[model samples]
Target: MPKDALISTQSRHRMTTRIWHWSNALCLLILLMSGLTIFNAHPRLYWGEYGANDDHAWMAVGSSQTMGYLRLGELRIETTGALGNWQDSQGRTQTWAFPGWATIPSHYSLADGRRWHFFFAWIFSVGLALFMVMSLWNRHIQRDLHMRRDQWRPSHIWRSFRAHLDLRVIRQTAGEDYNSIQKMSYIGVIFLLLPLMIFSGLAMSPAMDANWPFLTDLFGGRQSARSLHFIGAFLLLLFFLVHMVMVLLSGPFRQTRSMITGGEGKEPLA
Candidate 1:
């Protein structure tokens, strides 16, 4: 139906790319769930050098005897079943910001959550570092992700965004070279957001803070770094959700098969 759909399916994902894709996916899943467990320990966010129970929080998820709510500055909204308060698996009422099913241990245990978070965190960090080096060595970054001068123009970007919104481009290109918008999103996730998530996490560590004060200072403070880390994780989650939808919408079987086997269905174009 479309020109690119009829184009060659000769393009194959490299082994490193395929491995990194799935490994990164698993790492993010564990990190996010466990991170939620850790967040339930505080359930509040603040800016600047220090924050405490007595101090003002820019955002907080809390509950009263009768209600669970999310407070954002001066605004408050009830979130009884999902945030601030929810029932446990056994139907016992709990007052955690996130539900048990969404967290790692499915129970309140900051210690255990931290253990799970840190263990997978190392895997995520190491896997990301290796992916980057391999990507560079293979020139995958330069050849595949690099955008042409015309693709950077406002008109070109707008068209690409519109195509993504309508699912036109992805359905056509599928396993072919990524469109401009796709490349930019991948670039941001790979080079910027992932690194920020890692370094800001390190900035929140007490040992890193004491040994490398500059890391903490770079992000303003431990609390600020924590805030940034949460934000970065949120952005990553957003990307993952949208990426999944795109893959499923375009053709999940074809895409998944390519990533797993590192080969396309068709040998060459018509």
Candidate 2:
């Protein structure tokens, strides 16, 4: 085997990371779809301890007989034929906040949606926990993600940001080395957004409220926790959109192959 090829096979993603990456991806996707279905049950968000039809909500999606609209605070947007109301594959008009295609079961079933979301949520949580421990144990986080002292400089940071904006690949010592922006994005998603999604989800549960009242109180209230969970999920979706664009620009085949084989195309390193 060629020396460079050998290095490439051994140095990019670990077997554990690759496994977690795909499983976590699957988990998040289901959680998002089912969570959207659950959200359709109450397409409104509030900030206080409790929320209901009569209360003022920070955001809402509702449809009238002929039209659909999304209201955020005082501003209202007519979302007709898309959100608040949309047609399913069968051409039946749906009054749900999100259309059937975007949700699990592709129909209005809060109970089923909750089941799907919660089942995947557990898988997602366990995957994250294991990934965290493995990354640290393998020094993947420190070796690949942590910024050197020089990378902390404003000039390097600015350059990295611009290069990312231009969709330019910054090949450092090796092809697998992530730029500072990549590191930060990964860190934010891993340590902040994903965990927030999990905890806020727990905070909304009646069992958590009963067993650990402080968890609910930590987020101010149930309504606030729900709002935060929605926001976190949105941010995650945005992160994935940008991540896919970056991958496409950087060569999806090579990047995806690395994740798939994890550098051991024939015999994986033990």
Candidate 3:
């Protein structure tokens, strides 16, 4: 066999990370779609413990006789034919928070949506817990994902940021791992954003609230928890978009093959 072939075939992603990565991807897709479907059941958001059509909403999506509007506090903007209100294929008027295309089943079904969301939520949560334990045990977190002391410096961060803006990715050599921005983004998503997502989700659940009232106190109220959950979902979506863009920019085939087959293309050792 050629030397380059031997080097290129070496593993880049660990078996565990690869499995978790794909599993998490599936779960996230299901959860996001179903969650949006569920969101359509309540298109309004409030700040306090109680809110409904009778009470003033901080944010709401609805339609009047003539046009659809999205109201944010005192401000309102027309959102006809997209959000708030639109006509379906049957030529019937419909009002929903998110468009049908953005949701699971592409039609309204609160019960089905909740079931999908909860089922995937459990899988996602359990998978995350197991991944965290395995990562810690294998020292993968410490060894590969950790930011070096030098990377914490403003100069290093600025340099990395500049490199990213210039579309100059620092490719990983045989022994090296992720670049500074990659490490930071991974840390933020895995350690910070995900935990917040899970906690806020639990806080919004009535069953969980009954079992652990402290969750409600921690997040202020159920409405607040719901708001936070929406925010977390948005952040996760943003992360996923950026991640896909990076993979394409960095070499889609190479990056995807690494995740699928756990191999990296040959690179000179640093």
Order candidates by lDDT, high to low.
Answer: 1, 2, 3
| Top model number, lDDT | 1
Q: Can you give the lDDT of residue 226 in candidate 2?
A: 99
Clashing pairs in 3: none
lDDT of 3 at 207: 93
Encode model 3's per-residue lDDT on 1-270: one tens digit a residue: 655335433667778899999999999999999999998898887776666789778888887545788888899889998886777768777787777778886888999999999999999999999999988876668767899999989999888787766554434322346768879999999999988989999998889989999998898888888888887898999999989877777778878887898875434323
Query: Candidate 1 on 65-181: residue-level lDDT in tens?
Result: 567999989999999988977888798889989899989999999999999999999999999999999988877787678887899999999998888877666788776667799
Q: For candidate 1, give the lDDT.
A: 0.87
The models' CA-based lDDT, in order, is 0.87, 0.85, 0.82
Looking at candidate 1, what is the lDDT of residue 268? 38
Q: For every model in order, what is the number of clashing pairs? A: 0, 0, 0
Winner on TM-score (1 vs 3): 1
Tens-digit lDDT string for candidate 2 (1-270): 544345335647778889999999999899999999999999999996899999999999989767899999999999999998787788877789998888997889999999999899889999999999988887778767787788888899898888876644432222556777788899899999999999999999999999999999999999999999999999999999988888777777877887887743423222
Q: Which residue pairs in candidate 1 collide?
A: none
List RMSD in Å for every model shown. Answer: 4.2, 4.0, 4.1
When summed lDDT is taken over every stretch of 10 residues in candidate 2, the lowest stretch is 167-176
Please give the distance, in angstroms, between residue 173's alpha carbon in candidate 1 and its true position after superposition: 1.9
